[model samples]
Target chain A: MSIHRKNVLGAVFLAILGLLPLFLNSYWVDVLNSIGIYAILGLSLNLIVGHSGLFNLGHAAFYAVGAYTAAILNTHFHIPVLWLLPLCALTAGLFALVIARPIIHLRGDYLCIVTIGIGEIVRIALINNIFGITGGANGIFGISRPSILGLTLRTPTHFFYLILVFTLLTIFLFHLLEYSRFGRALNFLREDAVAAEGSGINTAHYKLAAFVLGAAWAGMVGNIYAAKMTIISPESFTFWESVLMFAIVILGGSGSIFGVLLGAALIVGLPELFREFASARMLVFGAAMVAMMIFRTQGILPPRPRSYDLFETVEGERKA
Target chain B: MSLLSIQRLTKNFGGLTAVNNVSFDVEQGSVVGLIGPNGAGKTTVFNLITGIYQPDQGAISFEQASLLRLPTHRIVSLGIARTFQTIRLFQNMSVLENVLAGCHCRMKSGILSSMFHFPRQQREERAAIDRALKALDFVGLRDQAENLSKNLSYGNQRLLEIARALGTEPRLLVLDEPAGGMNENETAQLVSLIERIRGMGITVLLIEHDMSLVMRVCEQIVVLEYGSKIAEGSPEEIQRNERVIAAYLGTEDG
Candidate 1:
């Protein structure tokens, strides 16, 4: 699609989403919120899995860390959960940086395997109740809803707007990053690390940075999820959660924002829509993914190949 | 003074020595060519100088600082850049995006600033594009800037590689077999492009199989035979050397 039309389409989609809560029933609205949360998670994973071309099956560990941090701190200190977004992001980012620092040096399938181990390790650590804080798999409760300017975001519409804001912010920020110098560097790493290094990009540094950023974004989303649900559990974040998020990124066309959003809806909403086929929903999802791989291997809305009409226009003017 | 200096560089893969006790210097703003037959290991020397391979022994200093122990990425930012013997453009990126990536070494905007689009970051970004465009113009790829890099014609792709390398603003640019696949016309364009790049005041170290192009463009030539320097002199002088001829033929007989 042309860049201009894509922007218009995106704006239209956002407008519909912005007005969705007023007409949709409570359950559907809540489902959309879940989709929004997953969208952020998918975008986060896309940074590592799609843009940087690293196979990471352990992303849920960071999400779990953030959710646990928010859950533990909010219950004990009564600090507003939303206020802890920065802390959530930092802890997850630092966790990824430290744990991934050693094994992130592994490439491709090996990296994927190690990340799986890391994710399992984090989940088990929470269940085992590290430091007597994690509640030992019983999980935590009584988490308060997020508020801004003293207004508690309690209703479905209020929660819709909450995750909506974060989703938009993620889209805007990832969009900027997709076009930024950092994004280009990541693309080079994705295509060929040696070539990227030859082009003067520090490939290893960029790879680790991508992991940190993706983890941190998911971590922030964890804060929102904790507040929205009003409870947290270890079961909520598992190896399966990582798999679902990775699937969303893949099914969405990895690096495409719209693709990811549509992917989130399909992955998060399809099962709900086909409640009669709840057992078969995963089978359908699997078939769809296989079909997508066969037909559109690049993803449904693969990020448009970057272009520079502006440069060509400037070149034209120079000649004229 | 030399822009780049190498001393006693060597590398081995098992029993075979790829580069053995090789030493060379690239003077500031001069075009020097390193030519050799297949498997003589001219590209190995480029890899060693570019920090892709740590020298088993000896030192590489660019503008009087040790290049040893530095990572490959750091080597580029230190004002040394190279192209591969095989084409290695980021095939999925736009042609312009590929060159813009080359400006990475010079661009200083950090991750936060870029995400936020801070004013200073915006300025650097614009400047970076302008620099990238100039490099593209330098290689006659200005019109093809908006196309996907992989879509470019093979000759254009080769030019795009140079544009990408020149985008790094390197003090010394290294090209490996740049004219390897080009036909006569493309080779002619490449010759003039190298001349234009040199006119921009960058030193060059090139490894090429095309002797005619090398003899025509290079002021000084280094010849390699079985991982060792067999000849070093002006193109005219080396063309007349018996050992150099024997090395090219892989035999001592007439």
Candidate 2:
């Protein structure tokens, strides 16, 4: 009900974007759709890395979990994709909870290493096992598009709308969560876990919440990918893909939602547009990341400014 | 029963026994001071009571319930809260947010409600904010609610830490060095503040170095020397104890 000015501008921008498919070709529209997916993944990653100050190296694990869950259910059980979206998100979230319980308990580099292991283990299992159901390394094909009533979501225009809706929803949800009390707890954890815990927070629960919610976002995007590509493969869920997601979050500014979107567009959109110079792209990105870390450790966007109205209760004068 | 009772509590760090068989009691609606020389293990006792360190051998009971094996947050939720000697605040957060985080244990909405922003969750969140504001108001920093805590002056930061702990609505509040680096006036103000806190009917346990302030405000004093309890008495009794005299002289001689 209390829509901020930023939300109003965002709504207007979305209204303009809704009409873009009328002007663009199917190929361009498909590329745009992919951008939406990447943006969602980037935003989700941002929650843990940027806002929560978690260093995640295996976010693609959740993305893969989402994609594979949708793929498996549709391919085996013939579940309708519309109904499968939430299911896939829940599956990914549950898997995240299970994996995060042990892995998220470890902080900093240890967490990164464990998540990397999870991502690798999941991808390898998908590739090596279940030759009959998953097509193993060859991957699953002929995955049908989602349909609503009698309308098939096979065309790029239709898929664009679907991806846009999910992406917008993800953005909306991320913003809402960031502004909530839970989000404040995450920010406290990010600043200093020990201090946050000392403040009487159940630090473990909040960290788990960040991991689960982030996975859910990635999973939703994964469902969209499964429908758009009509195929799901282990090759698509490589560990490097996880690293790339990390890159987007860092490049954009860890806690900034808009930063993630910009990061995703830069990382995913630029490479395709500059395919001729593909070999140098990653090298440049790596260099830029290094330089950015050195020059702008806070990233492109600054962390949210601390609001003083929130501090009105501490009656003492400033000390240190 | 006392508001807080520590019996035979012991903490060992490898070969170092940081706290050895320390036992004490905090009466409800009173201020108690834990004081000693720099290496006296006053902080270690606070840590043990707050569940930051597992006591090797002892029972800690609050309001007649055993707290020896409970986790830190659980201890806090049971109406025991504390501030650190080094002032551990959520520096990047607004002062109010730092305090609001202290209210997390009291939040009843499940994680599902939090993520979805359910109506109940919103109500709880608002209530938390209102409660945090009241805690901030108690500390007199209500005007700086939105400022990053790290930017505040040192004195205010100390107050902020206490206000944050107060957000937990503790019946027993432990402050580790509330006046560590403060000036004489600040220490005097702090002495009054501790009295006001005790006035609220909450038990107060503090570790302090300002001898004048501690002597003036504490109803009872417990002294530690090299991880051992040397004396326990009223402030006037502690100041005249031969063992207390020797402990301070030992540091001076060193």
Best by lDDT: 1
Model 2 Cα lDDT, one tens digit per residue, B61-169 = 9999999888888889999899999888888778888888888778876646666899888767767887888888888898888888999989999999999999998
Q: Provide the lDDT at B104 for model 2.
A: 79
| Fraction of native contacts, model 2 | 0.54
The Cα RMSD in angstroms, rounded to one decimal, for candidate 2 relative to the true structure is: 3.8
Q: Model 1, stretches more than 4 Å misplaced?
A: A1-12, A309-320, B252-254
| DockQ per candidate | 0.66, 0.50
- Among these predictions, the greatest DockQ belongs to 1
Candidate 2's displacement at residue A290, Å, is 2.2
The 10-residue segment with the lowest total lDDT in model 2 chain B: B106-115
Q: TM-score, each model? A: 0.96, 0.94
In candidate 2, stretches whose alpha carbon ends up further than 4 angstroms from where it belongs are A1-8, A130-132, A306-320, B251-254
Per residue, candidate 1 scores C-alpha lDDT tens digits across A1-320 of 59799889979988997999989999999899888899999999999998999999999999998998899999999999999999999999999999888887788999999999998998898889899998888888899878899999998889899889888899899888887888878889999999998888988899999999999988998888899888887898899999999999888887788788888988999989999986888898789889999999987888888654354335325533
Q: TM-score for model 1?
A: 0.96
Q: Given the true complex, what DockQ would model 1 score?
A: 0.66
lDDT of candidates 1 onward, in order = 0.88, 0.84
